[model samples]
Target: MYRIGEFSKICRVPVSALRYYSDLGLLPPESIDPESGYRYYSAGQLPRLNRILALKDLGLSLEEISAILDEDLPAGELRGMLRLKRAEIGQRVSEEQARLARVENRLRMIESEDRMPDQEIVLKELEDVPVVSIREVLSNPQDVGMLIADGYSALMPAGIMPIGACFSIYHDPEFDPTALDVEIAYPVAETVTDVPDTPGGRSFERRVVRGGRAAVTIHQGPYDMIDQVYTRIGKWISDHELQIAGEPQEAYLTAPDDPGGPVTEIRFPVA
Candidate 1:
C-alpha cells in the first residue's frame, strides 16, 4: 500500500487534488491508514484516474465523468451519448471548415472581381419542366441529396424522362446559404406519386413568370455560373423593371459541361 504522497507522486497528480477528488467520491483510494489517518491507494487505480483526467480534458466535469463511470449504463445508451457527442463535434468541425472555405473563396472572389469580365448576358422566356415533385424543407444534409436522387429514381421507373434538368428551386435561405429551403424537381409525364394522374405527384398552377425579359444568353458551362446567371438576371430585372415570376429554372438542353467549365444553356425565364 502506498501512502497518499507516494500515490499522488506516481499518478503525477497533486495530493490535495486527489484528496478533493476522494471527498467528492470521484476516485476514492483503496483504503485508509487507521493509525496515521493517511490515505492509501493502489497502483491498480492509475487507469481509473487516467480515465478521469481524459474525460476532464474532453470538457467533462468531474461530476459528469463520475456519473458516466458509475451509472452502469447500457451499451446502446452509451453509444447514443457518444454518437451525439460525435455529431456535435462534427458540426463544429464542419463550421470551422466552412468558414475557412468561405475565406478562401472570398479571396478568389476578390481576385476575380478585380479581373471582372464583361461577359454579355441576356434573359429569355424559359420553359417549365413537367414533373411530379414533393416540396420538403431540407434541414438534414444526409436527406438533401437523397431527396432529389430518390425523387428522380421514383420518377424514372414510371417511364418519364425529365424534360428539364434536376435542380433545386430555393424560395429562401432556409437552413443557411449552403443549405436552403429548396424545391427539387424533374420533368416527368405530369406524373403523380400518391395522387394518381396528378402531374408530378403535385399540382402547381401553370403560370408564366412575368418579368423584364432581357436578352438572355445561355451558357453551356458549369453549375457554379448558374447562380451567377441569376445574379445577372436579377440586376437586369431590377434595372429594366422586369419582375420575375418564380424561382428561375434552368432547362438543361444537354449534358452538363464535363470536367467543369460552363453550362450548356442556363435559361433564365423572364416576363
Candidate 2:
C-alpha cells in the first residue's frame, strides 16, 4: 500500500488528480486511515487508474469515463470507441491541412490580381460513362448542393455506391445563374439497374454521358468564383480555334463540405 503522494509518484499522476478521481468515485483509494483519513492506494488499483487515464487521453469526458468504468464496458466496445475517435482525429487533421492550403492559395491570388495567372487547360478524349442521375430546374443556384446531397441519399436506399466522382451537367444553352438546368449524377457500374427516385419527385435514371473531346481545367476555390475559370477556358478554346459542341460538365474532385472548398474539374466539349 502507498500513501496518496507515494501512489501519485508511482503512477506518475498528480496527487490532486488522484484526489479528484477519488471524489468522483472513478479511482477511489483501496484504504483510508480511520483517524486521519489519509488515502492509501494499492498496486492492484494500477490497472483501473491506467484505464481511466487512457480513456481521458482519448478525449472521453469525465462523465463518460465514469460511466464506462462503473459499467465495466467490454474490452471490444472500448476498442471500437477508440477506433472511432482515431478516425475523427485523422479527419480533423486532414481538414486543417486543407484549410491551410486554401489560405496560401488565396494569398497568391490576391497578390497576382493585376495579371491573369497561367491556367493550365488540357484537351482529352473522355469516354462514355453510365450514371444514375437527377435532373432539376432549380430557381436558386445555392440549392444545387442540396439537390446533389438528396440524389446521394436516394441512392443509399437502393444500395448503390458511386463508382466515381459526382458530377453535374449544365444542360442550358447559356449560363443562367438564377435558373439552372442541372443534372446531378453519380457514375455507377454498367450492370447497375432499377435506379431510385429522389424525394422531390425526380427520378434517378440511367444515362450514358456521351464521349467526346473536351477542354478541361481544374478550378480550386469557392463555386461563386468558378465563372472566372470558365472564362479562361473559353478564351483558351477560342485561341485554339475550337468550337463548343456540347453542354458543360463539372465534376467535384473534393467533397462539397471539404474545408479547403470544393475542387471542381470543369469540362467543355469542343470540336
The candidate scoring highest on lDDT is 2
Q: Using alpha carbons, what is the TM-score of model 1? A: 0.39
Give a tens-digit lDDT track for model 1, residues 160-203.
Answer: 56655665455662226545566665654554333222333543
lDDT, candidate 2, 228-269, per-residue tens = 998888887786667999999999999766888778999999
lDDT, residue 59, model 2: 85
The TM-score values for the models, in the order shown, are: 0.39, 0.56
Please list the C-alpha lDDT of all candidates, in the order they appear. Answer: 0.62, 0.88
**What is the model-wide C-alpha lDDT for candidate 1?**
0.62
Clashing pairs in 2: none
**lDDT, candidate 1, residue 208?**
25
Per-prediction count of colliding residue pairs? 22, 0
lDDT of 1 at 118: 52
Q: Point to the candidate with the largest TM-score.
A: 2
RMSD of 2: 14.5
Which portions of model 2 miss their true places by more than 4 Å? 1-118
